[model samples]
Target: MADASGLELVEQALGHRFSDRTLLEQGLTHASAEAGYSYERLEFLGDRVLGLVVAGLLLARFPDEDEGEIGRRFSALVQADTLSEIGGQLGLADHVRAASGVVNDSILADVVEALIAAIFEDAGMDVAAEFVRRHWELRIDAVTAPPQDPKTALQEWSQARARGLPSYHDIGREGPDHAPRFTVEVHVDGAEPVQATGASKRAAERDAAAIMLSMLDPESHG
Candidate 1:
């Protein structure tokens, strides 16, 4: 296969190689990077599968919690950042077969879901669910902290204690139209700035501000 190396890398990172090689191949294919049969389709399937699995898990784990709590936790677990972080952790970047010039992590998010979808298709939902449980359950279970919108949090912090409103700038953009990645810089009124990247301009800006806040509150950032 053309992407044999990529396939091997995937198996290495995943700790299990696919019995049906084509499934793994499909998982590694991003529409922007590949000609056809991309991970987009798998991502769609995985999105639904993820929702089902998470909902079931949340119900079992948080028996006393209400619907709103489960929904929030599910949203947090399936968020883009969480997926991207999992992709990075699994070293998906090293194995992902994308088109030239598509270096952004946007594809990373879809690829994670696509891989899950592939696993579900190849082995079955039971197999895929267990894999997800091993990798995601603990993180999903530990919901001790309140979620804050990083951009809003930063803005309010600046307004309350800092000199003025925080400023954000689109520093750079990369990749094609379908999946352009943005780099954003956030500057506080009178403080040093922070920069980060995301799939959308808003996401990048929020991440940059979040990074800045983490610097300000290291103890709470975790």
Candidate 2:
């Protein structure tokens, strides 16, 4: 059985009540918990749902912009960092169930996605889209221009200064085989090397490069 108070709190945060409370409970469940009951499948469906809604929202909001520009905005909007930030705002970490007794940003982000799937399953696409628009509109409206890819931006910054390209080294890997976490360090010519972790090597490298960029010019990147 699901905890009534906890479900109520999550429903309030999501602004959508679930008809099948089990769906919400399953969505909040982590793989680390019960073997057969995890949010992975819901997350898979939610990922596509989120992408479609966000893409539609971008198209409607920026009718004059070309595909490339809208694509950039779409990427930024659906990135794990953005989802995790929204999850934190909703206090999802407190509600998610994990065997380790700790929930990381990735888990929180996944839970948020799973919750979106739950809403879609319980109600319909319209309700799911409305929920997404309400929570994500402020973020979408705040952007004056499409953001650059962190990796490309870092490379451009280095090349403009006649500095050699950034180098990324894989420092470590952890977690289960199905969900490995990678640690990567980005080294610039003169500055201190910065490290970051992610669910994949590419993501870790990208995060490291972003950190390096922020360190070099806090005003521009930060």
Candidate 3:
């Protein structure tokens, strides 16, 4: 059993009290702990729960957006980086149980989802949804505009389609090292590859991604 006060600290962080203490423990237990019940299953369910709740939030917040624009924002909210940022805000790493007693961004992200599932299991969907809304709503508000950087926009679009991130290939570079121009191609599944050239590799990638985004929909990236 977990210490009484320890669980309370976590409860305070999560902003919800758990009736089933075991569920709370399971949510914090890493797979390496071999504790019979790890957070993996909870993480899986929490991922979906989060998506459903976040989708609702996006619809209410951005009713004027097309599916493509909304999907980019949705991808940002549910991505591992955002989840880990949320976990860090909740101070979740200090509460997790694992062999190393340390957690990475991926583990922290999974733990956030697991705790959402734990909340859903312990109380109900209302409380779980409230938790997501309370945290994620602020995130949406903080961003005055959804991401618009070309490469970032393209990557978000790819992830939104469940096609993973776009891959960038460097075709070639020319001119002197100090003034070399590079050509890059951006490729995503189910989409034709697009290429562009720029003063640097990163610039070329950005241009290629922009070209690809334009081909998909001239105004979809806004």
Candidate 4:
């Protein structure tokens, strides 16, 4: 409803009521908005909270899965893409207070974590875990098997073709120190070099390798 407040809609989407309204407000405030408070700190705490809950969910859901398999599933579930997708489904972007025209996967992902932290702070781990389960259950169920790590897959592909190992180089860095962006170039013998940007060098390398892998074998990547 257009008449409904942003916080109200967010609370509805999250299926939780906030005792301290300030937490919800802070969670929705972006760093660029110049709001005296922002979501960064909450996002940091929520990241760890999300990880622990997701790990517990995986262990309970797949008792037979070994640590490696569970770890892969956990990584996929907590990736920025996944979090942003979930945020979109919950209409979180509509409520985020950011500078005009500022929107990205990182922002959306950060706010989602911030909200989770707020919930955890308000109602403790049980409520926070339940909220995660409610929103993430379908995704967890839809995954038939743990997806292969893109970097590892790319390395195996290069080795199979006798290309030795792919090399990664940091080509550029930008943005603020707190939230820096890194651009990495990945080079493999006999193939055109590919580059990608991410919040960190490791993430950039993974992205570049994934792109290169997709280019080299579209069907496999798909």
Overall lDDT per candidate, in order of appearance: 0.79, 0.88, 0.85, 0.87
91, model 2: CA deviation in Å?
Answer: 1.4
Question: What is the TM-score of each predicted model, taking all chains together?
Answer: 0.72, 0.87, 0.69, 0.87
Model 3, residue 166: displacement in angstroms?
7.2
Runs of candidate 2 with Cα error greater than 4 angstroms are 159-165, 174-181, 188-193, 198-203, 215-222
Q: Which is superior by lDDT, 3 or 4?
A: 4
Taking the tens digit of each residue's C-alpha lDDT, what string does model 1 give over 1-222?
337777887877776668888888888777766466777888999888877887888888878877776766777788777888888998887767776645456678888899889889988998889878877888865776435577777887778774588988878998677678799999886668798987989779878988898787753344
* Candidate 4 local lDDT, 1-222, one digit each (tens): 122477788899999988987888988888777878889999999999999999988999999999999999999999888899999999888888876645666788988999899999999999999989988888899998998878888899999879989999999999764457899999988889999998767779889999999899964455
- Candidate that would win on lDDT: 2
Error of 2 at 50 (Å): 0.6
Tell me which residue pairs clash in candidate 4: none
The candidate, 2 or 3, that scores higher on TM-score is 2
Worst 10 residues of 2 by lDDT: 213-222
Scored by lDDT, model 4 comes in at 0.87
lDDT of 1 at 32: 62
lDDT of 3 by residue, 166-185 (tens): 99998998754323568998
Error of 3 at 18 (Å): 0.9
In Å, residue 182's CA in model 4 sits off its true spot by 4.7
